[model samples]
Target: MNTTPPRVLTIAGSDSGGGAGLQADLRTLFACGVHGMTAVTAVTVQNSLGVTGFVEMAPEVVAAQILAVATDIGVGAAKTGMLASAGIIEAVADACDQVGIGRTGTTPFVVDPVAASMHGDQLLTDLALEAVRGLLFPRATLVTPNLDEVRLLTGIDVVDRAGQREAARALHDLGPEWVLVKGGHMWADPECLDLLFDGSEFVELPGPRYDTKHTHGSGDTLASAICSRLARGEGVVEAVRFGKEFVVRSVRASYALGAGVGPVSPLWRLEG
Candidate 1:
């Protein structure tokens, strides 16, 4: 019997801190029982405090990595994070279109829409943001953007559930199959809510709001988890639900690692 696990790919940056980026992505994928592959787009110099600096890989190099993985090992589902520039965004978008979406096989794509770090360091530029929408958004199976990102992408202030609906609609106009507006930053509330819109209906997924500062890689973990579930053939709603549970559990298990905020622990189950 072929016991090969489902494969999921992460096209994102590399975090030297080991708390986020490709590191977090791989950990989450493994925890979900999937094979994790990477197409590194940038190398970030960062720690718990924040990103000190970063160097983006060339567009050609980024494309090469994706092609190498897609043609050889194959990707069941893929997620992208921190494509820092327009060139990289276009390259990754075009590559995914041809090698993943355009291919006869199904390879679902998840867009994390990482605009900044938890510490408030900008990751995506204005040019890159436009490129992401114009080039990548149309090809995405799902786009998971936080409140700030939703505001950035749609120019709507999403302070409540009402705003989320408006933003989701505006975002859907940009052209993704589904939109998940993450409300994890709704700091004033005890209950955390994430809104999912599939161009028809809205699903409100609410989870326990954990008060923790170690949420450094929470976004990456959630997106990776969703991609992993999608690779296993779960529906968009199912994958989002699983992703939320995974992130909340991971956040609950968060612990301090460095001087600043720590990361959500992907190994929450094994450690405790």
Candidate 2:
């Protein structure tokens, strides 16, 4: 009897802080009972304080990493975090297309449009942002963007649930099969309500608003959880719901580690 776990690939940057990016992604994937793989796009001089500096990998190098795994080990599902430049985004899009890892391909792709850091540090440039919307959005099975990213991509400020719906529509227009407008940054809200739209209907995913500053890797954790569930054969909606529940638990289990903010813990999965 074969006892191999499902495989999920994360094409994202590396955070030396171990709070966000591929570090968080791999952690979440492991907690979700899947084999985690990566295609590193950049390396950041980041810590709990913030990202002081970073360096992006060559476009071909990024593409080569994807090809190396997708063709041989095989990816059941994939998610992207921070493609730092336009060239990197284009390269990733081409490689994903070639390796059949998008909406039109065999593997489901989750595009997490990481625009900035939690401390308000910009991660992607305007050019790279446009590339994410034009190049990756169309190929994504699901695009998970926070409120800030929603504004950057759609020019619509998501102040309320109605605004989230509007942003979801605008994102869906970009051609992704589904859109999840994360409302974690909306501090004014009593509950953290994430809106999921699939062209026609809207699903409101509401969770307890945890009052914690240790949410450094929450976005990466959520997206990676969704990707992991997809790799485990769950449908898009179900996977998203599972992701939402998983992230809420992680946020609730969050703890401080460094001087700045710390990360949400996926170690809660061990409780069972």
Candidate 3:
């Protein structure tokens, strides 16, 4: 096996609390043995539990940053999360199209359509959602969304396994080459399941569910994990499986750090 580190880029928001968004993506990439890069579109005033406020960086700056990265160090894989506004979303989508053209097959992207915080804070506006659907999803290799996000994206209320498949298929029709309907919010027992529809096959990944409120960045972490592995040349199905295990482990070792819900330690394995 080649030991050279794969390079992954994350286009997302910054979290002052260092739990989710860019911080979580970076941590997950490092844990997975990949070099991480970032283009922060928004900065959030957030704590362990939720987002209080967020400020978006200018769209031009985001575009420039992405161009700089693409022109210089280069990216082996990329993931986008929490594009807070339509302008930034368009900028990211445009830049990613170039990245996709230049780095196709070798560099895939995992897009996490972060619509809201677990504590009910709105992170994505309807305009941004439209931007995501129209600009980003068509260019994404994989789009990861939870139940609520699935409903937002496709108006499908995924209540069970069957609903998961329906939602996944519906999301697939939206242009993302692959759609993962995250079942973390599903009302179920025994396991946490995620359904992946790659336009051709539906892959179901199931694992022991860890009951915890300390899951601030689970989606970001999982998507980043998939990015890291895809950068290392792992197949999509295998990458999703690895991402699930990584997230479960992170949740199992989640530390409640503040008054509200804490975040999973995506780099928990490296803690000494």
Candidate 4:
């Protein structure tokens, strides 16, 4: 038998559509050659079109799942998405502490501040945001937020690359060790510009923007991809580079599923 290189855990919600959330994370992780485990925080009645409704697991159940995974098989990196409430966020953070990140003594945590799903559906309430800012961010290795999420979380309008950098810094102050502010909303821009602030310097990642509406679940997929790569020992910048590529390809290969905006197939590279 051969041993896998590394393992990754995703503490996130489930997308019945199998396009995003824990499903997307799992596919991305597997596609990247990393072992993927999941602790589902919520369940969504959704499809490639959009999320119709979501039922958040109780905080206790959420914590139990985290422990169930953390206590056994193990993980090199973990990412969180769509924590629907403050109580759930708190439970997850506490569970992380108990698990002890591993031999390095700290687990790489990727927080995809998912207050809303890709279809603009509201997921996290105001109170949930509060718990995230205080309890979760401080422990996160990287916090990935798109333009709207950045504005909602930090109250900063990232209208340009420079603005994105400034917003990343603000989010860094909020506690995450690093922040990546995505610029997908800057439609006028020639490329997809993302800014990452690692407490000291700002790293800008630029990619050619694909002109398409099949961009649902992109942020979730990117963060999860980065986390999976990081679990395999890729540095932050390199992980983000691969993550962006994976997302772009997924978006380019996106397929229509329902009557609304379709989701980016995170497994596009493999399925192609």
Q: Give the top-scoring candidate (TM-score).
A: 2
Candidate 4: lDDT of 152? 73
- Best-to-worst order by lDDT is 2, 1, 3, 4
Candidates in order have lDDT scores of: 0.87, 0.93, 0.83, 0.81
Where in model 4 is the C-alpha error above 4 Å? 102-104, 119-122
How many clashing residue pairs are found in candidate 4? 0
User: Which is the winner by TM-score between candidate 1 and candidate 2?
Assistant: 2
- Model 3 Cα lDDT, one tens digit per residue, 84-165: 8899988887777765522243468788998866843456778888888887787778899988888787777777898889
Worst 10 residues of 4 by lDDT: 100-109
TM-score of each: 0.96, 0.98, 0.94, 0.94
**Cα lDDT of model 1 by residue, 1-272, tens digit:** 97999999899999999999999999999888899999999999999888888999999999999999998999999999888899998898778877855222378999988986674445678888898888778888999998878777877877777887888899999999999988888776578998999899999999998767788889999999998889998999999999999999999988899899899998975664
- Model 2 residue 51 distance off true place after TM-score fit, in angstroms: 0.3
Show the colliding residue pairs in model 3: none
Cα displacement (Å) at residue 220, model 2: 0.5
Residue-level lDDT for 187 in candidate 1: 70
RMSD after CA superposition, every candidate: 1.6, 1.0, 2.2, 2.0
Model 2, 11-48: lDDT tens digits are 99999999899999999999999999999999999889
Q: Give lDDT tens digits, candidate 4, residues 1-272.
A: 89866888888899898777888888878778888888888999987667678888999999898788778777789988888888889888888888875222477888888885564445678888888888888888888888778767887877777787788888989887788888888777888888888999888788878877877778877987898788888788888888888887787877776877677886666764
Top candidate on lDDT is 2
